[model samples]
Target chain A: MDFDAIISNLPLYLKGLWVTLQLVIMALAAGFVLAVPVALAAASRNLLVAIIPKAFIYFFRGTPLLVQMFMIYHGFAQFDALRESFLWLVFREAYWCALIAFSLNTAAYTAEILRGAIEQTSFGEVEAAKACGMSKPTIYRRIVLPSSFRRALPAYGNEVIFMLHGSALAGVITIVDLFGAAKIVNSRHFVPFESFITAGVFYLCVTFFLVWLFKRLEHHWNAYLRPRETIAVPTIAATAAD
Target chain B: MRKLVTAVVTAVTVALVSTSVIAGEWKKIRIGVEGAYPPFSSITADGKLVGFDIDIANALCAELGAECELVPQDWDGIIPALLAKKYDAIIASMSITEERKKKVAFTNKYYNTPAKFVRRKGSGIEISMEGLKGKTVGVQRATTHDNFITGEFGEAVDIKRYATQDEAYLDAVAGRLDLLLADSVAMDDGFLKTDQGKDFEFVGPGYSEVKYFGEGAGIAVRKEDQDLVDMLNKAIDAIRANGTYEKINSNYFEFDVYGG
Candidate 1:
């Protein structure tokens, strides 16, 4: 309702938007890259290869993102050994702590999605690739991975938006993300409704944009699965064939 | 005529007595207290609320012969909750600030303490602007200490505000903050004396400027509840006079917290 407050604080929100975009984009990119190997290992029949990734995924997925963030930012800081370790360089900064937490958490969720898609790869598709004398690596690189990505696209899109929302927790750790900006504005002006609604609108816009982006990606990648278009041939075409 | 006069007098007396009963008696007082600020108010592991504030509240209620109910509320929402009638008054160590006076009224301060900055014992961080430049200072969000630091040293320091004083202490212990500003008594009793705070010591002079820290911690009531405010003020005076306040103050602190 306070248009003046929202307008005056526009720059703050924009700065926060930048931080949020950076966190979400970096987290998603990092998560996707990490997810590929983990998903492959998780889909593997070899217990030794699958067990580690499975445990990693289970631990990250089972706990709340807030707890994970706190564990990294506050919990790890409790140990003097960690504080003295070289890893403290990364763990000390709240921004990096939030980034690492978001990346790991999203990586787990994305891996699970990809693992499901990989397992659901049609038996015939692998058989056909094998019959064509394709090696395992070539089959995976040329056929399995691409198809799995297409199948996982919708679910992965959901994960991207969820990560965006989850990145709000970064603010709690002291990073000035979008929600943090709103909190600062609210605390200063005591306008919780105006401040939070502004943040909510920003989130809604990003969510809608993500939805549109995913829709286009899905359409482009699943083009082969769409019903084939019918064509009418002129009588001259039949004559030409003769 | 005499009989009619007597009947009217009796009716008027009955009405006056009933109205006084309804308006004057604060029989059950629901006092709001933040259970996060330890040594002042905190919830124990078993969930019982106990601290200086709790004891003081109970003593005040007992002095007034009213049954008291302690409602634990988050510090951030304490004022709004009071306005919404979540409780009759707040016994939390709320500074008697000018900004708070616009909405809620305050009883006379029961205890007064100055704010101070704390840091790692050997950090040698000066309290000056140049000295604290680029240093991260932690404070409880929305507190007078937050206001003072943000207004005075915000440009010089990276001010990190937490929802509770304990969170700020946690961050301070974690070495995330170079300085911590809060009530001297609170930081002394709540954080500094604890094992996690062994390395930290009070760094700067105590800040008790009336403009920033206000007149000290007072009971807050709704503006409309002037009667309740007056009653609580009288109770505060009675307790202080009866040595009840001294007993509670000594239980949590070593020195006189009711500042001159």
Candidate 2:
């Protein structure tokens, strides 16, 4: 309600947005890297290859990220063996734990999304690549991946937004992300509306920016797939074929 | 025809539930409580809310001649629930502070306690900033103890804020945190006395400065409920004068926690 209070707290929210941006970008990048192989394997014809990725996808997607975070941040520390391990160094830091959990969770979801898109790739284009003596790897690299990515862009964009919101969970573990900043402001000032609404608008701005960015990417990448605006003309084959 | 009947039934049901609250009477009331913080409020094994805060709420309700139902709520959303009219009053051990006064009204404090930090028995950690440098300390988020440590020692220590005091205690016991901060009485009865918390001991000076702690824990109501506030305040005074407060105090603590 108090615009002045919200304005005064802009610095805190901006700081929070920076932290949120870092988490989202890092997690998305990591997830993208991991998801590529998983999606590839998931799209494989070999049951063994497909099953391995499927299991990883199933586990991460099945469990809640919050539970995974708690298990990493607090649960593993409960064990002496884990404490003695080198992994403890990363596990001890809430930042790393949260990032890993978010990355793994998003990777599973992104893999599934990419897998669906890959399955939808045109069989005609694939057959054309095969007829031209393109190897499996080249076919996937030049034909399938590009087409699948273009198709998957919108859904993946949605996943990015969900992950952006999901990064708010980092606050519960004390990462000082956007929602964390909102909580601090709310706690300090007892102004929930001013505190949360400020963060809400920032999230909205980020979402809009993301949506616009994805729209541009889709427009350019899928340009060839679009129906061209053209003048009606008779083809030369109609007159010459007979 | 069935869909039309269903629509009519749903509308009537919604309206009846919406307007059912008995206005201007304390005959029946819903009290929000977090049954997680032990010794103050917690859920027993049999699913009953049994603790000092519950006893205090019961005493207050008896004084008001009202039937009170203690609704368990997450501490994070307790205030919002009160604001949303999910419950009339909060009997959670919510500290009374100027910040809180901006949103909801609080009755006179039932009890007050200093905040303290507990560390491992053999850890040799001092409470000073230099000694606590690079050490991880855990406290429940949004708590007075959390604000105190963050305000005072944020530069010196790595503070990990938990959603609940119980979570902080668990981490402290598990050695994930070097130390944990919380209400002294809660630390004493809720954790330090428990088997899981046996490895840790209070290591810091108790913090009771009014600037950080404000007044004691108070029953909270919406700001517009002045009549309810007055009635609750009178009930609190009556409980104290009639020794009901003393009885509940003795049930929870060995010392006077009224903060007077």
**Which candidate comes out best when scored by TM-score?**
1
Q: Give the TM-score of candidate 2.
A: 0.86
- What are the lDDT figures for the candidates, one per model? 0.91, 0.88
lDDT per residue as tens, model 1, B46-65: 99999999999999999989
lDDT by residue (tens digit), candidate 2, A95-129 = 89899999999999999999999999999999999
Which has the greatest lDDT?
1
Residue by residue across A93-126, what tens digits does model 1's lDDT show?
8999999999999999999999999999999999
Off by over 4 Å in 2: A130-132, A229-242, B1-25, B223-227
Residue A172 Cα positional deviation in candidate 1, in Å, after optimal superposition:
2.8
